[model samples]
Target: MVAISSPGIGSGLDINGLIGALMAAERLPLGVMNARKDELNTDLSAYGRLKGAISDFKSAMGSLGAIDKFSVNAASSSNDGVFTVGASSTAAPGSYSIDFSDNGTNQLAQAHRLTSLDFADTSSSIAATGTLRIDLGGNSFDVVIDASNDSLDGIKNAINSATDNTGVTATVITVDSGSRLLLSSDKTGAANSVTLSDVSGNVAATLGMTTVSAAQDAIFLLDGHQVTSASNTVTGAIEGVTIELNALGATGTTETLTVSRDIGAVQENVQAFVNAFNDLQGMIGYLSKGDLQGDNTLISIQSEMRNIFNTAPTGLGTSLQFLSEVGIKTTRTGELELDTSVLNEKLAEDFNGVAELFAHDDQGYAFRLEALADRQLAIDGIIDTREDGINARIDRIDAQIENFEYRLTLTEARYRAQFTALDGLLSSMQSTSNFLAQQLGSLPGSAAG
Candidate 1:
């Protein structure tokens, strides 16, 4: 008959288990909130994927929106070993006869090979002191050769480190006789010739440096007109064309250089755009059949994209007005298929017309798509608005779940307090009943009478 402090011990019932079962019922709303939050999170992730796909499509459209992309020109030389060529959009389609006299030369000055003289490695010092005057083209600068920089390698380093030494580089070349300091001009034209003279000391005569190669101009003839270039790469010879002379063409042997619109590059760009559009379409299709089934936002986006394909472009003053005209067609499965032969034929027939169809000043298909994507993906746009709505719902559900959890805690505590008191009261009643029965049994004289 010890005081039963434990709730279940006093009544011989599982009071704690009962309280747990009651609290489980109270937590039902929390489960619902969690499920709803998971659904919203899935939707948020889906929208982010959709936004990324659309942005990729927009970038692909950018290439098609520019006329220059379609106007790419390729230049080819009859003998590529002699010269390789490149052309910009401004180049006119034509042919030219190019003749080269000799390969362009760079101005070079080498120090006479010193046989007996030897110094420490590149960092060693010499006792010689002098100021070396260097001239390149018309510019002149003086390099001071002091004890700190008097060695052969030190003079090379000094020439290289001079801030005012333009168009000149110095190097030390090893030979069977000895190491020689080699100085070369960066420029190749005769006007960029280099010379060296020691004004203060015998540094120039001691180094034995003299000109090995004189700077000369590159002489060539384009369409029977004389052309002179300072460098091997010549521009402005043909408008929008840069000619890179590899090796000098044989004297009097004219090579043919041809410039034409590059239909291959145009085809590649178009194919890229088509591939990007298909990828976007496939992503939308997957979302529609999966997590976003019956979603109105996804349905609207898909409809608008399909409409763009079907609609004929406006304001183009050409026969090629639609993508279909260029052999781009939509299939039943919502993907684009390209007929390369037909597209190539169209490009060959009217390159300008093809360019206008996709990149016209106004109402071109690529331009329209670019504008649409920009608006839809901007801040506060449709995708962002949808995400905000989903987030707001999730926040509200979280608040409700927190409030229910607090209420359940208080309710469990109250139930435990009441049940404990009841167990104590039942124990007292049992004790009272036992005392009364014992008193009755003790009356032995009354029972005999």
Candidate 2:
């Protein structure tokens, strides 16, 4: 049955007044219902955004969940000038034996010597120079002095800046009132030689004589086997082992032993995955909670959010009910936590079994749970029903307003026509009265005459 509106007005309806009253009532419910629906829509949209964020978080965690690793051993240098991987020096300053029997030795290394040298003057009224010249592998560079034209301290500045260069660096050490410059080379070879030509005016030279020592290639033993390596650190000579020289000491006692990315990198990868998983749980908790001190809508959602991991996938055994199997768990306050140690233990114990756990039967627990969380846990979930109801209410309100408008329009038209006819009748009656008054006045004047 069609519903009838009960706006009071049977006989003489005021068109404008009736229309105005009906419109006011209709507008109120229409506006209110639509506003409520809009608010719900906004909420649903926010939920969608959060849901997407949650999905991204989960995917990120999944990506990190797997182990990742790369070896960090020093690179293998095919020859000199090529950077390679290996250990450094550990021995004290002393002599050692090296056999370059395979690669042989260069005569230039044996005969190399300094031709000319210059040291900056500190008190000659000119800025101290930090420049030094060195011939590395027959390649020469005008090594800038550590000191600059700006001050008398340029010599000290140059030494510190020579890192990752062709030559070594040294400074003067003081004993009592006497000081001498200690020089070190970047490489260990007969070719690695240094000579001083103009140290008389240099800062530390004024205190002592500058000496150029005979240079030789680094001599060391790999596994006690004599190996004459051109450079101090030998890389790829053995897998995952690198050697660095002891600058202040000899070779054996203090060689720098560097262990490459051996096997720990894989472990680090797994831990990274666990950390990412924890991060995702944190985001889920934040999105689901409302307040810092207490709970709200977001909190309720968080509390219920655990359903994503609480159930096992279909056809999979009940053993994989939660992330605890893989080391993720939820707390009473609705936070997700992970223990990487436990996870790593599980991975180490049964990697394939765990893989099957995530993909057991057809789709694994993680996959199914992720799908459910991404699709069903929020407002637009399979069982969740509120947005549609609100929208329907709004639509119903709109229809009622439309019906009210139609009724009011018809009533207004009928009333306007009826009132127009009544106005014509009143006008005719006033005209007739004026004519009768004129007739009566003329008859009375005739009697007086």
Clashes of each: 1, 47
Question: Model 2, 90-149: lDDT tens per residue?
Answer: 222222222222233211122233211232433222333444544455654444543343
Per-model CA lDDT versus the true structure:
0.79, 0.47
Estimate TM-scores for all models.
0.79, 0.36
Best by TM-score: 1
lDDT string, candidate 1, 184-301, tens digits: 8887776787777888987876766656666777677788887877777888889999988777666557799999988888888788889989998888888888777888888877
lDDT agreement of model 1 with the native: 0.79
Error of 2 at 151 (Å): 56
Model 2 TM-score is 0.36
> What is the TM-score (0 to 1) of candidate 1?
0.79
Candidate 1 ranges beyond 4 A from true positions: 1-23, 101-127, 133-135, 138-142, 163-167, 197-202, 395-449
Which 10-residue window in model 1 sums to the lowest lDDT? 107-116
